[model samples]
Target: MSREQVVELIPALRAFARILCPQPENADDLVQETLIKAIANLNQYTEGTRLKSWLFTIMRNTFNTRYRKREREVIGLPPDSTNTLVTQPDQEWSARAKEVYSALMRLPDQYREILVLIVIQGESYEDAAVICDCAVGTVKSRLNRARQRLREELGEAVED
Candidate 1:
């Protein structure tokens, strides 16, 4: 992969990884593993295959393996239960914004990822599709649905 291509893929990888693992550190680790694996297997990548999708697949696969391992572990054995149920901060600033942000946060992680990719980041429909490992039409449809849900939750611009 070209240096610029790798650089461009970083944000997309992080976004996809974040959806897989909510913890920033775990997401970063996933990204690191993805980069290493992608580079190591770069020769296997076909010229026409979408690199973003390839990277996302690697990230997702890594997360799934980690998740499955965690799931398979015996639950009651861990004594490290201190703060196992970490909570979101109660941001006391601007109640309106906190409410709106919370609503957006409540969006299904899949929808939130699409919203971040398409609307917040202003990525092209095609690029977002590649990052999301879906078709261009699917990306467009998800973006529309996410926008509608955000609007509904924020109670603005309700249309027929």
Candidate 2:
């Protein structure tokens, strides 16, 4: 991918990072790490492929790696340090949006990733499958399960 093309995807990368990392600073750090890995491994990138999906795959892998590391490191630690104070939203829509986001965050990583890739980022099933390194049927199944879990988390009745 050209330098310009990679630069243009920074915003999208940051948005995805934010979803993966709830803290804004941590999200920015993840984006920076993703960029570093992508640039360092530029030779591995195939020409004529979707650069966005490639970058996303890198970001996802990076996040997963870091998450697993943190899980191991946090054994028997106090939970207070992980909690952040959130301010209440002023507007009704903003409150609703925050509620939805909270529910989304409670989902397992695979489910959340699929939802963000397909529903939020608007990636097609094929592209999402490529980014997620899974088959198209797997992606669709994950998306369906993610939606159902999200709705359940939000106290909504599941339709069939």
* Candidate that would win on TM-score: 2
Stretches of candidate 1 exceeding 4 Å from the true structure: 3-12, 47-53, 64-97, 120-122
- Using all chains and alpha carbons, the TM-scores for the candidates as numbered come to 0.64, 0.84
lDDT of 1 by residue, 1-160 (tens): 6768977989878876655554456667888999998888888777786777667666666766675354224222355763332223245758886676667766765678777766555667787777667898988888788888888888888784
**How high is the CA lDDT of each candidate model?**
0.69, 0.82
lDDT of 2: 0.82
Best by lDDT: 2
RMSD (Å) per prediction: 5.0, 3.2
lDDT of 2 by residue, 11-128 (tens): 9999898777765666788999999999999999999988999999999899888854553244224556553432122245676798887788778878898999987688989999
